[model samples]
Target: MFKRLAKCIAFANIKGGTGKTTTCINIAGYLAKSGNKVLVVDFDPQANATSGLGIDGTTIEYSMYDAFLNQCQGYDGIPITKIVLETSVENIHLVPSSLNLGVASMLLQGTRDKTGILKRIIEPVKSFYDYILIDVPSDTGLFMLNSLRAAEQIVIPLDPSIFSLEALEYLKTYCRDIEEMSDHVINQITVVLNRAIISNSTQNSSGKPSPSEEIESRLKELPDPVFVVPQSLLIYRSQQEGLPISHYATNTGKIGKAYEAIATHLSGNSNVVTIPEREAEYAS
Candidate 1:
């Protein structure tokens, strides 16, 4: 079981352009709006989380990179709040990422056990927030492993395309690896199909590929996803505006509605999981 944990979830996938950063922002935003104190850690070197919240990425002196190295070298634990910058929303804060983060995997390998770096660094800060959402890079590498090890669960966003199936297959293998590391009990990874057509059910109207069905069947061999994120152009535009949909009060558009629903799902009110039999097994 994960110790010192308070609902840590990572928005991750090896492939890019799958709405990883966009999903991370909205999820953290809704959680904070629900009166839950939330921290968003940008694991990617790109610093999308920082920019998404309107923080100048270049101004961040300390990033996740420092936090990991500090732990590896036996330095004093860095207070997360020191690195976190307030967003327009009161309850949500961010641990910004740096361009230097691009080389972190290489730098981390010789420094210490890279896989558990994030896990150890985050252990102390878990109690500070009701939820900690990590926005990871869109690639399977040493860096991704560290974030996965730290996560209590995983959230994957798919763009609902043909190539996405190939990516899902790879993720299934990744889940197995995480399971093997943790005594054969895989951590829950929810797959969310983003940017999907609204009317399309499990199958597309054309039957080329019903994103819901194609992904669900592939994941059936692994774990079932919680739900699909319907296509919403407003969500994309919100990110471009450097603000959360909730903050854009005037635009009570599709993206805002979808994010609210996602927040509801993440609140753990529903019995959403791969194996219901194991739900009680993993309940904290």
Candidate 2:
């Protein structure tokens, strides 16, 4: 099982409300469900990953922050049994985040090797999981720099909105800076367009093209995003109940199928490279 493990991946973007947390939790869960031992490191101080996976964020005594502060050398202080918490889905574990992570970020900023702190901390546990998925905060700060440094691949979740497109450009700029500043080489930073509702809303009122068509046209103008996660209310309901969409809406049809497709794509055997664009015509 350990032999099949590959590089850790971080999911990040400079924009909030992009479904970054949702995709992180779902991808980790799906990977674990597919028989890989998955570890999700929740780097967001808001603890969305922790709560999303059914772990009460406030109760976690040892978080990623503690691991960073001690340089992961004092991990022994945490009981072995308590180091990882299982999610509602089998095979998935979470390293909960604490509010103190904000302080940890401040401390990281004071260090010379700011980009490598997370990498150094995760190194000891690298061999234990088949895949490690990091859910980073929305801001492009030292925390994100550490996340990128720790990862070989990055997945950016983008909401299909004008602001999100602008944010993607900003994130790309940040990625360039990180590459210039650190020795880390994130070779696979793929983008995933999320909340892709196929609205038939277009500019021309007379037989206007669909919203999905508009989105598709936009996608055609650039290099493809890795995938487009359709907007499904199932996700919202599941999140409200602290459950992964796959687990909560397992039999709900299209949404469940979409998540399954995402899982399949992540595992490297699917034709997920081409993303279908949505038709969304925004009034400028």
Candidate 3:
């Protein structure tokens, strides 16, 4: 069962370009729009989530690096509250990432508790929000390990591609290893199928099963509930405009509604919302 405090979820996939940052931004946005206090930690060195939310990571005074170093040294180098910045989206905040975060990970490797540093950094401030989403990088290094350690739940954004399907298996194995290592059970794991093409025909031009069909079949075999976000040009446009799909487009639209459904699920409203059935059919 999830703790009564803020729910910390990490959007993690060891494959890049699977829309991890995009998922983090939109879900946090919609959740905040729904009147929940949300904080997005741009844990990825790429800082895409920071930039996607209309914040210039380069200009941020204090990034995750400061917080990590502070925790490692046991000195109040900088509080996470100071590092957090408000976004244009009301009720949403961010701890912007920096290029220095890559260097910090290297430095963290020498620390006694590298994997637990992020958890330490987050412990102080997690209770301040309703949801805290960490956008993790696409690597299995100490940085990714720290992210996994800090988060209570995982949200994996997967593209409907053959490579993504394989990556999902690898991620599951990785999570099992983490659970054994840390003795912390990740209570919930939700997979979102992004950039999916919905069609009545199961097969595509090559006559093999379409990506969505294959993904759905594979996901059903697992215990996790999967939600599908259809392929749409609105996503790109929203990114370009520095706004979330829920903000740039109407929440009732295909793309916006898909993310809204995800937000509802993440907000512990699973009893109030049927995510897999409603989103899958909407995508179709």
Candidate 4:
């Protein structure tokens, strides 16, 4: 049995460009800024989450790929603690990914317990952090399967498009299948609407509901509340500069607040409290 002390949450979507990595990093930044220890496991071979937090994957000697392969070969995997690197954000660390991780699926193909590899790799270090956020690749393969099996909760980022909505439905089915196969039951699944355009005039111009409105309408039939992260130049700038929105702008900034609200909600805090000391801790 896996003993998990940290809240393992995965930001996963089958479709790309849904801001999965963006949401994972910013929320983790806010959580870490709040003084909670957080670890981000960059499960995607692209390593966007690794670079977005200002770490270069190429420079890392060992990565998630090594850990997964070592575990599969019945060797004590590279201890997750040894692979963890501190990010620019205080209290946040990362287990970066490399292009070699792209072949991880193939490596695990003939393994006896392929789906449970990640859970075993993370089990030893799970007690060391408050939250462990896994950034999964945009696919329904073994890599994504391991992420889903390892997480206690799943956060799906939707881009407010028909394709994204369809992908959500597919993910829901996949989750059900996973539940049937594993002992771990994913108790909570949150849907976050990213890059939402909230303009009534824009909706009227298109003779249809705006992206936000359309997503809201679709969400009413779902079990989770849709948190909105508005489209903003500041958010784009932050990403371009390889910083979390909270690090790029003050917590009071519109984009920053959106992430904070989601972070606070996920943390189950009824009141949002600002830790003044942490504000300057990671300030650029």
In the order shown, what is each candidate's alpha-carbon RMSD?
Answer: 6.3, 4.4, 3.2, 6.2
Q: lDDT of each structure?
A: 0.72, 0.73, 0.81, 0.81
User: Which pairs of residues have clashing backbones in candidate 3?
Assistant: none
lDDT by residue for model 3 (62-181), tens: 998788778765435687988999988888899998877787755543468667888888887877888889999998778778778888889999998788888888988888888999
lDDT of 4 at 195: 83
Q: Backbone clashes in each candidate structure, one number apiece? A: 1, 6, 0, 0
Candidate 1 CA-lDDT value: 0.72
Question: Tens-digit lDDT track for model 2 on 219-259?
Answer: 55666345667777877787888777666765756555555
Candidate 3 similarity to native, TM-score: 0.89
Better of 2 and 4 by TM-score: 4
Q: Rank the candidates by TM-score, best first.
A: 3, 4, 2, 1
Measured by TM-score, how close is model 4 to the native structure?
Answer: 0.88
Candidate 1: stretches off by over 4 Å: 1-5, 73-81, 182-186, 199-223, 271-284
Q: Encode model 1's per-residue lDDT on 133-180: one tens digit a residue.
A: 999898787767777777877888888676877887787688678767
RMSD of 2: 4.4
**Candidate 4 residue-wise lDDT, 60-90, digit = tens:** 9889988887777644457777898988788
Candidate 1 structure, TM-score to reference: 0.81
Q: What is the TM-score of each candidate against the true structure?
A: 0.81, 0.85, 0.89, 0.88
